[model samples]
Target chain A: MPNRQITIAELPTDTLEPRHFQLTETDMPKPGEGEVLLRVILMSIDAANRSWMRGATYRDAVKAGDGMPTYAICEVMESNSPRIAKGDIVAAEATWADYTVTKAHKVQKMPKVEPLSHLMSVYGIAGKTAFHGLMSIGNPLPGETVLVSAAAGSVGGYVGQIAKALGCRVVGIAGGAEKCKWVEDELGFDACVDYREGNLSKKLAAACPNGVDIYFDNVGGKILESALNFMNERGRVVCCGAISQYDTDTPTGPRNLPGVVVVKRLRMEGFIVMDFAHDDAKCVRAMQHWVSTGQIKVFEDIVDGLENAPKALIGLLAGDNKGKRLVRVGADPK
Target chain B: MPNRQITIAELPTDTLEPRHFQLTETDMPKPGEGEVLLRVILMSIDAANRSWMRGATYRDAVKAGDGMPTYAICEVMESNSPRIAKGDIVAAEATWADYTVTKAHKVQKMPKVEPLSHLMSVYGIAGKTAFHGLMSIGNPLPGETVLVSAAAGSVGGYVGQIAKALGCRVVGIAGGAEKCKWVEDELGFDACVDYREGNLSKKLAAACPNGVDIYFDNVGGKILESALNFMNERGRVVCCGAISQYDTDTPTGPRNLPGVVVVKRLRMEGFIVMDFAHDDAKCVRAMQHWVSTGQIKVFEDIVDGLENAPKALIGLLAGDNKGKRLVRVGADPK
Candidate 1:
């Protein structure tokens, strides 16, 4: 019966378990009026899934018997909704479940591309968030410099690529030489500094000689502090995520932010991609164009089976994923 | 013959020297090719004049044998430049000297006004700074809420009054009940909160129920912190001066500043009025109009004699000045 739907009955801290989800055998979720039944194909594993449990914005996660928080690409097997017909491939937000019944409008039609897999990578929510952070908040102009942290990660890779496409000199901060090289050579970033080399501040300063015009901060902590010293006057800092402090009991305080904002007259803003979902069509169109033009690239670190989802999430938190971490829940569509 | 102007080597920090300036006759100074000799009639005493001695902005205040950085109503007694002639009354930056020779353009022809003294008060640098901070950076649109700290002081008074004239609901934060009443009743501010009331945050929140849209921050300590919690989304904080932090060895950091920027997406920019000296005429005309129409009021806490300059400056630091603190060097010319 649809491989027995699994759901989280209780929250977990520091570790996750299969008990977080209850496997129940039942009739595959039927598409009610104005709804479509979606079969989960691919689901992304993120470090922020833990934080989603406590955040006010993710109150839906706290609802009893709700599935895990996940973004997945699915195939509409049945539809009573006018917007979607049978066999329509789509992307939707659902939990750790084999099948989900959702509103038709919530399912975005997957775009066609060379690597059909990229529909869930750079053209997906992670990639779109990075794009928006650079374009909307960072507002990088041609000839200006853009610095991105966690450069080898999916979001960081997209940030660097998008900034490069906009004619900005892009610098990336990552953990290792391999990741740094991949970000520079593969992702097309101008330069990548390895934060693992130590002396992060010194290296960052040397890399950004003209000073950073835009900083798309993903791994905020000491890296954000180091980047602040290199920001030029009237710089824009986009705070997309703070992965470095996500698991800590007490969030790290940025000591130098006050002086940075005052002396440089900088603008720093935080945003969530869900807030931009109202214009999903516009985002999808822009991302699709960039993907087709080869101006953007996507990397997927895929793991087989839903049983590996927790492990993939743990690996993501440990910085093991070179790009977007996805757990294949079912067979790929022909 | 005139005094080449000598004064106490340096005024004591704690007390005023009764014999601050001695107008002993030395020799009549000759005007150079681009210089004019001026007979001082009136001079302004500003809070910054105190820090001028320690080389704050105006490099090392007129050494023992030099003139002070005082703006005065003067008569051009002698000139070697074609731009100015003898017996022309002008406004010049002549220090505590009885008569001095300076560059011709440094002496601006005194504008005709009913109370000629008002020109030196309202059309002065402090007024211009207040205007620039309020209109340029603050940009207080009509029906917006504006809050000014140290609202009874020189710059703060203008900030409140100008905000009111711009159709903003203005709130003032001052130390005492008297000053608070003065800012609200006399300056036409919508509300005033006495910070000395112990619960400044509560009082401010109660007064500015709509939330502060623009904040003209003159005192930048606890008041700035309190205002941060009350800022509306997209609030603009004009940092004209941080008087509260100027003297302290270690300035207390505004605890709520980072959250203020993130939550409200606030813009806080620091500025110096000297940056707008090229467009001083526009500000002068605007201020004169506001004064002539009775839409603006000038508050001058006249401390008589140049000798009381030290006390007046100290009073300024202690938030003792009710409005613009001026040293009446000579009789006010009607």
Candidate 2:
């Protein structure tokens, strides 16, 4: 069988476009010793993918002609190691491809669910990221206000819902009026501000009358700047992602940082979801409870076909998707 | 006795000069009920005093025609409140005046020490600030690389020495070759980089080859910008003061902030010494031990007379003082 893969055509110096990636087909290969062949099922599309191309961050830098890295759910088609059996569903560091080959130890075996896409949404990166960044970094107290940017996006939608589940006042900042309404009405946030509308500081101040105690920042730049102005004394700013500045070469930062950080005695910290991988079982248990109770709503925006992966990411960067965005590459195991 | 006072003739829109203040003779303040009449023995000049004129910070904002506020060592003349007694030495919120009248309850009584200025330098605000910020915020571990800015100045001098006493590798960034040399030879830092010489990022990288684990920031702006580039993953940035931005109208912030902060997983926290006031005795105990063991060296730059108070502050902000800068307003009790 032929394996279709999306590869980076050229490194983006400024804004990334669909043309930056090209789809190519190659012959499928057999698994080597201690390795397993994976049929890529669902591939997670995140802002961090765009950031990887910018340069090396927490992960290795993506270069021209490199397969786009992704966090994906795959089925063990052929296993050479005794640790994994054929037909076992696992999660691993994958690429925007129809199939992937990795060491058996590198893949994490996942439990079966009614809907396999749930593994790519609530039980996967988006839900876990929101849980960890909000709980571990933000450390939200009951009744405290949590102000999150990119409210309608994958991790952010979960962040607000999780903050609400923890009995905190959750407010969101999304790009437009439609996203803001969905964030407030569907996600059940206490308030949602449209960043596209001017006077964010005033609007945020009005929405958060008590001031923000925890700011879960996904989109940095002007939103982060405005959030800094509304933070209460000794507040925590969870620096999850800087999607606003990720697509550009000329990225402007907050002009009042470290100064406002000093005056307010604020604690601004950052972390990757992988940092809390050891606590995954614990995170999953809590998330499962919230999901079952309906306190946490799961919304997976799935795009079909491997060919649309580039377009999905580009649209995601432009604030197109509403929830956990994933690209379905192949058929689910029946 | 006539009280000679320095009042802010006008608030500076940009750089503060001696001409912004005027020395005037006023009637000595009398003790009212629950108040004490204090003879200001010595006044501590700090960069934060200039920050106050810019706008409100941890303290109230200073306006035009207001007396320049100071942290001072004083001799109690008359006490209306039984909590404090006459002839007791105390530290309180005073001003650039020979006499001050404040609530007796607000004063902290001090133990008599020879050269009383030691109470203003090592055991006072400068020492406590360095202690609290380094120990509490920076959380320095032994054998860690600690990078401090404004190394020859009041708080920075003590910060480097304290970090040294804690068995950490301490590098300082100061202005001019003389100050840098003084910081290395006199203050005992591992290395001192003169920021004025240009190419701070290169020099800092060369100095801290192990990479900076904790950055004790004092003079924000470009120094902070350069320091962020050299911070190791999971580093801590102690935001003590921003003297560089305090004197200027147009203050530029670190352009890579919250981005570098995210990628590095750094914990950049800010604080006021008063936030740790409950642990003052503990801080003083540790500081006194360091001072007695010769691990911490104390330097007091005493500028004589109340008239020079404005000049002393201006010069201190301009990086003229080598250590804790003070203005002597009245004679110490015999």
Candidate 3:
């Protein structure tokens, strides 16, 4: 069978638009000694893709003419490992391709959920990033106000739900009314601030009456400045992503950053999910339990076809997606 | 007796010159029920004086007509408290006055070193800030590279020595050849990059062959930008003070900050020494031991008389002081 792959043609100059990628067809290859033939089902679209396109993002950089970097839900079509077999579905780090091969160790066995697409969304890198950042990095205390930027998106959404679970007063910052409403009304966040509104600082201050104790920053710009200004003493800012500044070559720094950090004694740390990859099983187990008990509501914005993967990522970066932006490559063979 | 005091006549309009202060003589007040009358001996000039002059520096802003902000070494002239008595020398939170009063708890018992002047330099706020920031916050590991800005100054100097004692390779950033040489030779730092060199980035890169693991930042601006650029994975940048941006009405933010934190998985925290005030006993004890063992060195650039204090402070802000800047307000009681 022919394998259709989205490969990087060149680096982004003006913007991280879809034109930077070239969708090409290649011949499928046989699995190696311990590798599994993965039939890609669903691929995740993330701001991190922009990082991979430009340079390295905590891992290897995606070079020109290379397969575009991705994390996807896949099925084991063929395998040669003692631990794996055909027909098992899992989440793996594969290319933006229909079918690919990877070592069994690189893939995680997916637990049975209503929609297996979650294995790529909440149960995969996004959920794991939020879990590690909250638990290991932020560690928000009970009744503390947690302000999450991009709160309606994948990682930010999970971060809010988990903070809510931990008895925190969760406040989310989304771009529009629809996303903000979804975050507050559906996701059970205490309040959701529309950053598109002019008075971000005033609105944020009003929302968080006691000042922010934990700021899960995904968007970095004037919004970061607001959060930094509004942070209480010893506040923790978990730097998950900077979707707002990802496209710019020379992004402006937050002018008020250093002084506030000193005065408030704030701990601002940025981390990659793989930093706490050891906590994967534990986080997945807890998330599954939360989802099962109806305490956690998972939202996904799935775009059909692998052809739209680049567009989906571009839209995700631009804050146009409602929930977890994902590209459905093929039907899940369950 | 007449108490001559340096008080701010008005806030800084343009420059922090000596003329901004009005040295007025006032009647000496008697020790109240719980206050001890302090005969000021040594006054410490710091970058934080600039902060106190303009706005709050983890404390209330100094008003226009108020006694100029200061931290001084003093001999108790009279006392109404059980812990303090007349003629006993100590350090207290006093104004830039020949004689002042403070509560007993606010004054610390002076530990006997070779030179009692260290009570205002190595054992005072600068020392404590460096100790707490390096040990409690940065937590530099053995063999790691610690890059300190303003390395010839009090806090940054201490940071380098202590990091060196902890088995870390310490590199420093100073302005001129003289200061850089002093930082490297006298302070025992591995290398001191002269930031005044035309290509600061090239010089810094050459100094720190391995990326910076811990950055003890005092001068924040282009130096901070360079440090942010040179930071290693999981690096910690301790924001102690922003001496470079202190005089500015509008400080330019480090444009490359938030992104580097994410990419490097860096932990950047800014803090005041008062936040770890409880750790005073532990730090003083350790520092005394280090001093006795000759593991730590004390350097002082003492200016004569309280009249030179405003000048000392202005010069300190301008990076004119070679070491710890202090004013010999009066003769040492010992």
Candidate 4:
């Protein structure tokens, strides 16, 4: 099949929108020696992608007129490398297209789990981010209250579950009542606060009376400020992504940041998944065990077609998606 | 010589000034059982004192119509406790008055060293703040570049010296040409930037050819922003104090905080010295060794008279005083 692709036409000019992307068609290129041609099944639209378009991210900025960067689940249709075989499923980072051709080692062969989609959802980017943020940075103590922002979203969902699994009292902040309800009821959070409401502090206070020990922060700005105020002494703010503040040209950061840091003894650190390249297998292995044991729930809000990829990303940034927001590009394997 | 006293007349309401204190006379209280009467020789006027005056600090706030809270080096004039004797010098926290009656348990006996004034400077609060910030929080590598704000001030001066002692390259940021000269010439910093001059970023970049590995931030606002941009990957910002933004009712914090934290993989943590109460002896011992061995320099900008305690504190807050800003309450022991 011919690949349908979306490329960056304009960089985020102070604000990001669907109009910044341009969709185009390209003929499928044959796999070269020591390369694999994969049929992309799903393209993950993540917040970090917005960072790439603006400036240098974990990797180089996705240059203008280039395909949008993404993490994809794919099935190899053709192989020229001895390292990989055709018909093998893999997790790879490639451009946002219906198909991708890359060096064989660029992709990791997907492990066999009950639901193959779980590898792309909970055991994928979101799961790795959550695992690193919660386990490595946060070091949540058992029975300590762990508060997660964007709780119904991909990373936050798994963070709350992992905290709960580690014997923490889990509280979450989501965009709306339905997301909050889904997070609290379905994701096993002790309580979930709807940040859309004005009384976020009051609601959050009510949710975690002991105060927040570990805050898995995905959204920055006001929510971070509120969470900062609600932190326990020596609380950890793991800055996974600042999705809310990314689009602006000049950032108006948290005003109350300094005062709380001294008084609360807070340690706030930011990290990218690429920084843990050596430990990706360890993270994946742990996440796979959690999923296979039914200790974690995986949810995917899959939007169909490469044509809808730009809208999917815009929706994800706007807090419009219910789960791990993805653009499904092809039919599932028989 | 008898004692004189200064008491808080008004709590700081947005702006702090000399009129907030009242000059008064108090009869020197005699030491009761298990107690010591100290002749307050040097009152260390610190930024944390401002925090104490406004509201509760690491300890209770200095109440209006009462002596201000301070850390002081004093001479034990009379002692009822078996552990303390008259004529011994001691370091202690007490209400800021000429004669303070504290339990012998509350005071640490000053170690015998030349220029005993070093006890009130480097072997005191500034020493502890710098040591804890540089050694514990920053954990600066041998060849890493460390940039310090308020480099001529008490804490930043010590931080620069200690970083150099640990084999790290040191750059300092001070307010004026004289202070910059003092920081570079006397403090052994690799370079010093006069922040009063414009093009701070350019000056900083010139100073730090390799990006900053640790930023011992004392002044907040724009200087903090400038330092944030100069950070290397996985750099640590030890949030010791924000003396620049302390006076304001509403804080307008660093703007580039979010982007740099993500891009640089920064870890920013705040710490108060009181948090290391258990390790106080270790800090003092280390500081004493550095001071007695002439490995560290202790500079005190001593302002005379108990009548001027309020002025001394106000000057320290306004960045008027150099080195450890302290008010001499009594004559040095002969």
Which pairs clash inside model 1? A7-A21, A8-A20
**Counted clashes in each candidate structure:** 2, 0, 0, 0
Model 4, chain A: how large is the TM-score?
0.94
Candidate that beats the other on TM-score, 2 or 3, i.e. the better one: 2
Candidate 2 lDDT over residue span B81-169, tens digit each:
99999899999999889999999889999999988999989998899999999999999999999999999988999999999998999
For each candidate, the DockQ is 0.17, 0.73, 0.78, 0.67
Least well predicted 10-residue stretch by lDDT in candidate 4 chain B: B111-120
Off by over 4 Å in 3: A80-83, B13-15, B81-83, B111-114
Worst lDDT window (10 residues) for model 1 chain B? B50-59
Q: Which parts of model 4 are misplaced by more than 4 Å?
A: A112-114, B1-3, B277-294
List lDDT for all candidates, in order.
0.75, 0.91, 0.86, 0.84
Q: By DockQ, who's the top model here? A: 3
Docking quality tier of model 3: medium
Ranking by lDDT: 2, 3, 4, 1
Q: Worst ten-residue run, lDDT, model 1 chain A?
A: A55-64
Worst 10 residues of 2 chain B by lDDT: B249-258
Here, model 1's chain A TM-score works out at: 0.88
Instruction: State the iRMSD of every prediction, in order shown.
Output: 4.8, 1.2, 1.2, 1.5
Worst 10 residues of 3 chain B by lDDT: B111-120
**Model 4 CAPRI rating:** medium
Scored by lDDT, model 4 comes in at: 0.84
